[model samples]
Target: MNTRTRAAIIGGIITSLVIAVFAISLNSNIFRQSNTQQNSIQNNVGITSKLKVVASFFPLYEFARNVGGGKAEVYSFLPIGNEPHSWEPSIQEIEQLKGTQLFIYNGAGMESYISKFMSSGEFSNMTFVKVTKGITLLKADAAEDDKEILAQGGMDPHVWNDPILAEQEVTNIKNAMKNVDPTNAQYYEDNANAYITKLNTLDNDIKTGLSHCKKDTFVSFHNAFNYFSNRYGVHDVWITGIAPEADVPPQDIQRVIQIAKDKDVKVIFSEDLVDPRLANTLADEVGAQVLVLSPLEGINQTEQQEEKTYLDKWYQNLHNLRMALECQ
Candidate 1:
């Protein structure tokens, strides 16, 4: 072959190699850019679709779950089966408050962590709901004074025990749900009405059962039933005052024992969360029976296994109350 022809062929092969390399590089860059765009789209979709909610405790969580109705993600600051008054949320949980959309709480003197959260402005962007916003409140009697207990004297926070107040809570939850998801307003209202109807039925059943009580007075280790007592016209001889474990003075014990003897009080109610020793001792002193009347602060292991709903626990409470008072 001629020299000129050989040189031309060598240059043409080099150029072909260069073009192939350039094409491969360009295709690789395009693929990487496409994948990155897909990832960005997915992340944005997740952020926009997530419905963040943080409930103060069990009752509030249950209410939020009912209203959220699978449309939103709901979580509780207080762990399941842990009492809210004593349980403290961790740093991770506090951080979750940053971008939360809804914050539901039992705001009538409950949630000691609320002030701190509000001060931090963690929930500034979130809409807050106090579930017990419109219920009739009951303050403990003047006679329910221990020096320590009187220091923190306020209205009872266990309003959920009264079905009537629970109906109000359901209403509040519905309002919050509608506020957050206006498009689902009718669904929320319907669910709330159905739940409130059940509450009314519970109220009627409780009233009917308690109507036949041999005595109107009932005793308990924890003062978790002031609202329940006042609602049903039943007298609560609470061994402890408003704050659980807030000192039971000697006079209070003496008075309780005297009343037990006088009224022939059949049963003394005790709670799982609080030490039952006090109630057991009091029952022994007065020959009264000891009964487990759960305060419904949280669900226990057994309750969890049973998948016990709020209404189940509430109806159980009604039965215990009726039995404790020895309803005929």
Candidate 2:
């Protein structure tokens, strides 16, 4: 072969090697970029697929959480230990509802600010679920002095205190979950049914537990237990009006003391989140002991850390009531 031809052949071989290397490097870079983009898209889809649920209070949060199970992410708008009757959401907290799909609230005048939010048209994309929609609300059994305050919005919002009504709330929440996330309808249905079964058992337990009590009337810090008392055939003589924060006038305190003495009440009940001083004073005046009768509106951080549920709190309340009533 001629020298020039040999040199041409060697140069051509080198040029072929360079082109092959460049092509391989380009293909490798394209493959990595494509893989990264696909992963990013999958992650975004995973996040958006889960239903975002925001509950107004503790009991509603519990109900929604149970119904939503794994398909939804549930949040409580009211922090633990805050009184729901007087709690007002801040602007930042309100802004957090932007991407939420469902907002579950107990709407029988429980949350005073809910109406403003509903009318603002700010959360048009979110579906608002009033768990108390189907249940019949009881009149707020407020004190005579607070009659005007109670009469303005006479309906009681503590329907969840009644286990039967709680079942209805759970059903409402389950239906809402199904409506928003139709693909997971059966999953939500199954979870709700299981929780409802537990609630039914709770109702039965309460009825049987209170049936044979020696006393039918009990004293409470506030009128939060009207639904519970009404359902179980017991009477509650509350110190304050519908809300725990309502001022207890001296006259009303004397009135409750007289009622407690006449009824031969052995226990004066205070709530978990309320100041126990009033109850202690009443108990001292009436020669009775003070016990906790939780409203289950919200629990403290310790209880939350302990993973206490509605059932746990109600059962504790039942135990306390049985002691107070001297149940057989």
Candidate 3:
């Protein structure tokens, strides 16, 4: 071979190697970028696909959470330890409602502003579910000043206090979740059944425990326990009317005091979230001790920190009932 021909072949081989290396590097860069983009899109789509569920209060939040499990983002809009009867949503909560896929509320006057919020004509895409929709509502004896509250809806709205009623509320929440995310209906239903079983046990325990009580009547700071009272035939007498913040009339206070004494009540009951002053005063006046009866409108810090479920809290409530009523 000639020297010129040898030089030409060597140069050509070097040029081919350079081109192959560049092509390999370029392909690797493209593959990494494509993989990164695909992953980004998948992560975003996964988050968006999950249902955004907002519950009006803790009990409904719990019901929705049980049904949704890992498939949805559930939030109880009310803060810990706030009474729902007088609470109104802030602008931040209103803004969040716009993005919510499903909103659950305990109707029958639990949330007075719920009707207004839904009627605000904003967020047409969001679906609202009221757990008390089909259930019959009791007339909440409201304070003289708060008569308009009952006039607006004319129902007690504390149905979750009763275990059977809570079971219905849970079913309503599960059905609402199923309606919004039908793909996960079976999953939600199964979870709902599990919660329902817990509720059933609570109901039986309440009935059996309260049935043989030495006394059938108990005094409460507020009228929230009428649903439970109705369920177990334990008469709940409240010093003040439905609104926990409302003050009772002097005559009404005397009336409750007399009723307590006549019934031979050993303990006066107060709610967790409400101030115990009135109950304490009444107990002092009547020469009786005071105990806490959870209304369960919202969770307090201690209860929240403990991560107690509604079922767990109600068992404590049952024990309180047994002690106050002298149940054997």
Candidate 4:
């Protein structure tokens, strides 16, 4: 072949190959764009997603989750089972609040740290639900005789321990969910109704189970169960006061020991995440058993993995109380 002919053939071959490569690259890009569009379409067609809510603690999270069902993503500000009274949210946690659509709290002295956020209205768009609204409160009756403790008269705010009051919390959460997403009001209402049905059954069961208790009083390490006592017609002799850390002064332990002996109370109840040395000591002193009665303020990691919710812990608490009080 002539040299010019050979060069022409090489040039023609290179042109054809370049054109084929360009066409394949363009087709590949088109395919990627099509897949991206399909993914977006599928996500859009999924069930209507609800707003993200952040609860201050476990009780609020439980109510919010019930109302939200599978629509909302609910999270607690504090990790499960951590004590909220002493927890301080980090800057990152505050930044997370920027995206939260609703914030729920117990509100009656709990989450005092969040007070500034509530008052300043940084979360103006974020609906704040206080679950304790409209529930009847009980005075600290144990303090009635102890003038020193009586001087501090704030109503006990752990009302979630009461099944009826817990339903009020559910109602509060339902109303808040409705306010935030009125379009799905029926969904929230249905969820609340279902939850309240369970709560009513729980109340009835508690009443029936404790109907024939030998004694009405039980002893606990902390004073968080006043609402539970008032609601269930049971009384608790708390060795420690509202602050879980309210150390059992030697005199207080002695007093609890004497009371347990007189009442024949076989169980001394303590909670998870707290050192139970004092409770063990008291139990040893009085030949009683120590049992764990979770307050459902926060769940530990294991409890979370076990899918333990406020209701589960509360039911366990009821069982323990029944065993402790020997309620038939």
Top-down lDDT ranking:
2, 3, 4, 1
TM-score against truth, every candidate: 0.79, 0.83, 0.83, 0.80
Give candidate 3's error at residue 124 in angstroms: 0.8
Tens digits of per-residue lDDT for model 1, 133-235: 8776777463244332233345567887777888888788888767766766787788778778888898898888888877888887767787888788988
Writing each residue's lDDT as its tens digit, candidate 3 over 1-328 gives 8999999999999999999999999898974655464345334433456777889988888888887888888999998888877788899877656457788988766776777778876645678898876787787677354654666666677788888988888888889878777777888899999989988988898888888878999998788888898888889899878778886789999999999999998899998888898899999998999999888888899989999888788898899989999999
Off by over 4 Å in 2: 1-48, 143-152
Q: List the residue pairs that clash in candidate 2.
A: none
Using alpha carbons, what is the TM-score of model 4? 0.80
Candidate 4 per-residue lDDT, tens place, 1-328, comes to 9999999999999999999999999898974665464344334322455467889998788888888988778898887667765577878788677656678888656665666787875565566777888987666534433332344345666788888888988998899877767777888899999999999998998888888887888898788888878777888898887656554568877888899999988899988867889889889988999999877778898988998877788788879888987878
| Local distance difference test, each candidate | 0.74, 0.85, 0.82, 0.78
Lowest lDDT 10-residue stretch of candidate 1: 143-152
Candidate 4 regions exceeding 4 Å error are: 1-49, 140-153
Model 4: per-residue Cα lDDT at residue 164: 88
> Pairs clashing in candidate 3?
none
